[model samples]
Target: MRLQTDNDMVGKRWRSRALTDDEFDALSAASPEGGFQQTAAMRRMVEQEGAAQTELVGLVDADDKPIAGAMVAYTQGRFGLEGSIWLGPLCDAHNEHLLTAMTMALHVAAHKRGAISVSCWPDDVYLRRTSDGEPDGEPDDLLVGNYEKLGWHHAGFDRGYGSIVNRWVYVKDLSGFKSADDLLKSYSKNTRRNVKIARNSAVHVRRLDRDELGVFHHICELSSVKQHFQNRDLAYFEGVWDAFGDRAEFMVAEIHLDEYLAGWQDKYAKFAREADRLEAALPESKYPDDVRKKLDTARRNVESAEHRIADAKERIERDGHVVPAAAGLFMWHERELVYFSSGSDERYAKFYAPTAIQHEMMSRCLERGLHRYNFYGISGVFDDPDDPGRGVLEFKQGFNGYVEELPGEFTLPVDRIRYGLKAAAAAVLHH
Candidate 1:
C-alpha cells in the first residue's frame, strides 16, 4: 500500500507496508503507549483462534524505520466486513504529519482488503488532561480534530457499556509512592479497612503459573454466574497466558482453612465467655433489659462463630489446606501496569478477597517501580445511582485514582453503500 496523505505532508517521504513479526515486536515494545493488545503475539492469538485475520501495518520514514504502526484485526461484523479494529495505535502523539500519513495509509490498506469501514481507538497517551486528571475538554478536542481532518468521523462519546472500546478508564499514578504503606495511605478508608480485613482473615495472594489456569477459570466461572456476565472459555485464557508470557501474571487469592478455622474458634471462645459473664450479671445489672439483650446478642455471635468453624473444618477435611477465593490477570508494559481482567468467588465475598488481591498487585507494581497502574475500562457515568456500572466505578474509586475520558472511537468509511446495506440488514435481523 502506498502512502496516502494531504498536501501538507507532500514533502515528507512515507512508506506503508506489512511489518514482519520481529519488526512488529520491536516497534510495539518501543512504543510509549502500546500495551499487550498491540503486540504481535496478540495478533497471532487472534489468527490462531480463527476469529480474525491479523495485519501489522507500519508507516516507515525515508530510512525505512517505522514511525507509526497498528495491529489491525479483520473480522466479520454485523455490518459487512469490519477491518482494522485498532485497539491503540502506536505512534508519536506530537507528530501530526506522521499521524495523518499513518491514518491515511491504514484506511487505504483496509479498503484494498475489502473492508467496509475502519475504526480506531487511539492510545490514551495522546489525550490531554488537566493536573487534576479530568479530561482537559476543549484542549483535548485537538486530538480528535486531527483524525476528523484525516477523513475519520467521530463516533461520539460512548455512554453505554456495550459497544466500542476506550471511552473511559481509571488510572492510578504510582510515581510518587515509595512503598506499599505510602500507596495505602492514598486509598479510601473503606478500601484500607477491607484490605486489612482480608489480611487478618488469612487470605493469601500469590502468582499462578500457566499450569494453574484451571483454578483461575473456576473462580472466574463463579464470579460470572454471580455478576450476570458471560465467562470466556478456558481456551481463550490459555491463549492469553501463552501470548503475553513473562509480561503477564495471574494472581489468585486463597484462604488457608486451618488458620481461618482456628481464628473462628478463638472468636467463638471469646464470645462464649463474654455471653456467660453478661448472663450471670443480667439480673443484678441496673439496666436489666439492656444487659439481657446484650447477653442474647453475644450468645448469637458465639453460635455463628461456631458454625463458621465447623464449616471451615469440614471444607479442610474434604478440599485440603487452601481454598481459592479470587483471581486477577495483570499486564506490565514499560512503566505502566494494567489490570486486564479479574474475578472473585461470591462465596468468599465476605472475606474481601478481591480487594486483597488488588492490594497485592498494587504492591508488586510499586516494587517494580512502575509509574502508573491502570484499572482498565469503566463507564464514565458515575452520578446516576442506578447505573449498572456504578458499583464498578465505586470500587475503582476506592483506590483513589482519577477518571480518564479518552477522545473515544472514530471510523473511516471505505464502502458506504455496502456498509449501509449490511447495517440495515443487521438492524432488521435484530428487530
Candidate 2:
C-alpha cells in the first residue's frame, strides 16, 4: 500500500493498485454490515460512471497499522459525489474517524477532477437509522453536529432537488438552491387517502413489456416538449427498466371503463358527405338540396370533435376507475406501497383516479400486513395559505401522516483549515 493523506496522529494509506471486481466483491462480503454507498449498488455505479483514477482506499494510522475495508469516488450525471466507506464486516471507533479523514481525501480527489462539488451519502448513519426504526431526522443531524462544531454549513438541504419518495434523496448542495421546507414536510391526511383510493379501486400494476415500451416512448416524447416536460431520452428509460426491473418493479395500474356500455347517443341526426363528393364529380342536376344539407351537418359534427373528447374523459372516470366500498389495495413492499406516480383521463374525475390509486395500494399492502400508508410527496411549506401550490400541499396533508423535519446538508471544504471550521459548524447546529 502507498500512503496518500495524513493528519498527524492518523495516516491514510491508499491501495497500491486499482480494485478488481473480485477484490471489490471479496472485501464487500467481508464487510457484511454495509449499505447504500458501500454495497454492490455503489460498486456498480462507480465502475460504470465514476472516474477510477481518484477512487480512494486506506492503509494505516499514526501507529502504522492497516485500515480495513474500502472507499469509492462516485458521480451522478456529471456531478461529483463522495461515496461508500465501509468498516470491514464490523464497526469501531476508528471507523468513524477514518471515514471523516477519507471524506477529506475524496474531496481533494473530487475537486482535482474539475468537479464543481463533492458529497457522500454517509451509509453508516443510514444503516443505524434504518435498523433502529427511526426514519425521522434531519439530513445532517448526526454528522452535521460534528460539521457544525467545525465551521462549514454542513446543514444545507435543497428542497427543490427533492424526491417523490420522501427522504430518498437526502442532499448537501454546494451551489444553487437552498433547502425549502415545502419539500420536506410529510404528506397530509387527505392526500394520503387519495393515493389509497387509487390503489383500493382494484387497479392492477404492470410494467410495460418490450412491446408496450414503444407506446410509452411515444407518449413520453410528445409530453417532453410540453411547457413543463423535462429532458429524458428513450435510452434512459431502457437502462432504468433493466436495472430496477431486477430489484424494483415497473408498475402502471389500469381501470376498466364501463361507460361505453351506455354510450353513443347524439341529439343531432346522422349524415354522410360521400354523396356530395360524387355529386360534385357528376352533373349539377344529380345533387339534391337534402343531400347538401346532410353533408353540411356531417361537417359540423366533425368540427365539434373537441367536446366529444372531453365528454369521453369524464365518462371513463365516472364509470371506470371506481372501486366497490369493500375493495382493498395491493402491491406495497416493506409494509408500505407508495403511490409515487399516477395519471388518468381527466374526464373521469368523479371516478377519482388519484384517490382510488392511493387507497387501493394502501389497502392491498395493509391486507398483506403492512404498516404505513404513504401518499409520497407534497410541495409548498408555509403556514401562510397564500403560498403557491398550497392546494397541492393541503391535498397531501389530508392523509394524516406525521409532519417530519430534518437537518439539511453541509460541506467539509478540502483544505485542513477549512475542514476544521466545517467540523466546528457541525457541532454548533447539531449536537
Candidate 3:
C-alpha cells in the first residue's frame, strides 16, 4: 500500500498510507487512549479469521511522522456490494485538524476499495475524576464534534446490551489509594462485607499462566450457559492472551476446603472456650437475664461455626485439595486497567469469588501505579429495576465507580446511492 496524499485541506498537507508493524506499534503507544486492539498482534489475529482485508493506515505529519492512524478490517461487498464494516479505529482525538484529515483520507481509501460506506467505533473517552475521587461525567465534545462535522452520522446507542462495543462504561480512580484497605474504603458497605466474606472463607486469587487458558475458558463456558449469553470459542481467548502478552492477565479464584475447614475449626474452639468461661463465671441467680443471653449467643455462634467446620471437612473429604470458583480477564495499557471479561461457577456463587478476584486485581493495579480501573461496559439505563443489565449496573455501582457515556458508533458514506441501497437491503433482510 503506497502513500495516498490529499492537498485540498487548507494550509495542511495530509497523507495516508499503510503503516509498518514498528510504525503502527509506536504510533499506538503514543496515542493517549490507544489499546491492544490497534496492535499488529491484533491485526494478525483478525487476519487468521480469513474473513476481511486488514490495513493499518497511518496519518502522517508534514515531517512524515505518523500522528494518527486506524486499524481497519474491511469486508469487501460481493456482487453489488455497497459498504464495509470497520471495527474499532485507534486515533488521537486531541488534534482536531489531524483527526479530520486522517478520517477523510480513510473514507477516500474505503471508497477506492469498493466500499460505499465506512463505519468506525472509536475508543471510549476517559472521564476525569472529581474531588471526591469519583469519575466525573465529562463528554468528549471535540472528538464527537469533529466526526459530526466531517459528515459522520451517529448510530443509536446500545440497547438490550447487544452491541459489539458498549457505549456506556463504569470506571474507578485508583490513583491516590496506597493500600488495599484504602481501596476497600471506596466501595459500598455491602461490597466491603462481601470482600471480607471471601477473604475469611479462604478463597485465594492469583493470575493464571498461558497454559491455564483452557481452565479459564471452561469457567467462561459454564457462566455463559447459566447466564444465557454467547461465549467466544477458545481460539478467540487464546488470541487475546497471545496478542496482549504481559499486558493481559487472567485471574482465577480458588478455594482450599481443608484450609477453610481448619480456620473455621479454630474459630469454633475459641468461641466454645469463651462461652464455657462466661457460663462458669455467671451464677444463675446473681446474673441478669441479659448477661445470661450473652453466654447463650456465644454458645450459638460456637454451634454455627462447628457446623460450618463439619460441612467443610465433608466437602474436603469428597472433593480435591483445590476447587476453582471464578475467573476474570484484564488488560492494562498506560494508566488504565480494564476488566474485560469474567466467569464463575454457579455452584460456587456462595463463595463470592468474583468480589475477591476483582479486589485483588484493583489492589495490584494500585501497587503497579495505574491511574484507573475500568469496569468496562454497563447499560446507561438505570431507571428500570427489571432491565436485563440492571444487575450488572448495580454490581458495578457497589464498587463506587462513576458512569461514562461515550459518543458511540458513527458511519460515513462515500457513495450516497450505494449506501442507500445497502441500507434498504439490510432493512429488508431484517424483516
Candidate 4:
C-alpha cells in the first residue's frame, strides 16, 4: 500500500507492501537497524512450525529500494490477534519522517491481518552503561518522544527480564584485535585463568551437526533445570538449525576421560621424580633448607596430580570415555557473533566448560573480522545482590564488556475496541 506522511504531500513517493524473500534479505542486511529477528529466514522458521503467520513487510522508495522493513508475526492471543516485531522496524531511528511512516505502515499491515494491537522492541540502544549496569550517558528522550508523536504507546522502562526480548546486553569490542591471543589478553584476569584451567583440565570444544541437536538440547535441559528456568525442547533446536543453516553453530565442550587421565598421570610421574631427586640432593646441597622446600613443593604437586588421576579414572568408569560438559548456541552475522543460548552441567562445573566455549566463540568472531561479540541479555538489576541475574552478569563481566540498554517496547492499538475489550475481560478474569 502507498504510504506518505500527511505533511509531506510533495515528497518522494513511497509504498509499503510484502517483500519477497530475496528482497527482504538484501534490504535488511544493508539496514543498520536490522537484526536476526527481522530476517526472512526467521519468518520461514516460524511459519514452518505453525507458530505464527508472518509478513515480511517493507516501505520502499520510488526506485523500489527498501527504506524500512520489519518481520511481523501475528498470533492469536487471548485478547485476539497479537502482532509483535522482535528487533525491528529496520530503519534510521533518527529520521522522524521514516520512523513515522514505518509505524503507520505497520499499523495498517497488522490491522489487515486482524491484529488487535502491534508491539515492537527495536534494536536501538537507549542509553550507554558500564558493564556493571551503571548509567554512563543520558537517555534518548527524543527517540521516545518521536514514537509517542506517532500515536504509539510507549511502554514504561521496566527493569529485569520481563520484555518479549532482552533490552540489555553485554558486548565486547574486538576492533583492535589481530588474533585470538590479542582477544584473550583483553579478558579479565579471572577469565584468562578460567580458560587456562579448562584447557589444562582437557576440556575441548567442537561444532555439532544437525543430527546432534539432541546432545545440545540435553545440555540445555540440564542447565535449565539447575537454574530453575524453562527450556526449549529438541524440536525447537532442530528447527533453528534447519532455518539458520550454516549461520547457526551449536558447540559442545567435552572432556575425554582417557586423555585427562593420561595427562595427569604423566604430570604425576614427573613431579614424583623431581621430588625424589630434590630429597636425594638435600643432604649434599649448600642450601639445605631450599632443597627441602623444593622437595616439599614437588611432593605437594605429586599428591595433587595423584588425586586428579584417581578422579579421572572414577569418571571414566562412570561416564564412559567422553563426557559433554557444556554446550552453547551461536548465531553469526556480519556485524557480530551472538551468544544466543548456553548451559553447563553442574557436575562438570569445575572443568569451566562454559568459559572455554565462550573463549572459542569469541576467537571465531575475531577470525571472521567481526568487531562485536554480543553476550546477549542481562537483567538491569546490578545493584541487587539477591537478584537471579547477578550470577549471569558476573560471568559475562569476566570477559570485559560494556552494557547496552535498549529502548523498551512500544505498542500501537490497531483495533482500539478489541484491544480495550480484551484488556477488560482479562482484568475481570484475574479479579
TM-score of each: 0.85, 0.49, 0.89, 0.96
> What is the alpha-carbon lDDT for the whole of candidate 3?
0.77
Q: Candidate 2: where are CA atoms >4 Å away? A: 1-99, 108-117, 121-142, 148-202, 214-231, 259-345, 359-377, 384-392, 415-431
lDDT of 3 at 285: 45
For candidate 2, write residues 1-431 as lDDT tens digits. Answer: 11132354343333222345445444444443332234344445445432343353433444533343445544442223333232221122134454445444445555565543443333233221221123555343445454444333443443332431133221111122122222122235545444544444334444456445544454444434432447455554454444334333333445443322222223222222443464464446465666667666666664454354455457565654432211111222332344433333443344445444444344444345545444443432435567554554454444334433323333444444544554567588897
When 1 and 4 are scored with TM-score, the better candidate is: 4
- Candidate with top TM-score is 4
Model 1, range 155-206, lDDT digits (tens) per residue? 7766656354657778888889889989888899999999999988889999
lDDT of 1: 0.80
lDDT of each: 0.80, 0.40, 0.77, 0.86
Residue-level lDDT tens digits of model 4 in 214-306? 889999999899888899988888998889898889999999878889999999999999999998898899999889889989999999999
Considering summed lDDT, which 10 consecutive residues are worst modelled in model 4? 1-10
> What's model 2's overall lDDT?
0.40
Model 3 lDDT tens row, 364-426? 988888878889877676667887778778888889877766667788877888888877888
Output the lDDT of residue 181, model 1: 89
Model 2 quality (TM-score): 0.49
